[model samples]
Target: LILIILSPLYLPILNEIISIITLSYIYLKVKTILKSTQKKDNEELTYSLKTHLSGIKNFEA
Candidate 1:
């Protein structure tokens, strides 16, 4: 058997983290779709998406 207790402090922090990650993922996916100039194959699409995402600057603290 297992039991878990949640802390009040953790909930808001976790929600913010998850929301940021989800929004970033969606933004990248949409940008990858919009930036392709020509029709791409599956491999090409994946490669382009990776390339576009890699070009994103690292967040500064």
Candidate 2:
């Protein structure tokens, strides 16, 4: 069949496109996860800092 004749020529290009899509999808997932984790870390840091500062204030008072 003509399909078989052309498949070898197109297969590499198809593979490249599929790989690119998969990589971008993975990259996006990792980016969102990192963003969420960073936000949580920032929130915890701020809370701890606030408590520490308040403790100092009480000690000084």
Candidate 3:
């Protein structure tokens, strides 16, 4: 039957769409986590640098 023949084709297409959507969701989650980590790291670095500069100024005076 033509219906039987078409069912197999539809299954693979449906699977492929599901795979694409799952991968995209994973990618966005990873990107968001990385961005937040980067921001935290930058803030820590800035704080450390400021502390070091003040220490040096105190030593000079």
| Candidate 2 C-alpha lDDT tens digits along 1-61 | 9999999989999989977876676566556555656757767655655665566457546
Q: Write the per-residue lDDT of candidate 1 for residues 1-61, one digit (tens) a residue.
A: 1223555567788889977996787697757575773566677777766675665434321
Distance from true location, Cα of 5 in model 3, Å: 3.6
* Model 3 C-alpha lDDT per residue in residues 1-61, reported as the tens digit of each score: 9999899999999989977876675566556555656757767655655665566457546
TM-score computed on alpha carbons, candidate 3: 0.54
Best by lDDT: 2
Output the lDDT of residue 26, model 3.
54
Query: Candidate 3: where are CA atoms >4 Å away?
Result: 1-4, 39-61
Candidate with more favorable, higher lDDT: 1 or 3: 3
The full ranking of all candidates by TM-score, starting with the best, is 2, 3, 1
Model 1 alpha-carbon drift over 4 Å, by segment? 1-6, 37-61
Q: How many pairs of residues collide in model 3?
A: 0
**For model 2, what is the alpha-carbon lDDT of residue 7?**
100
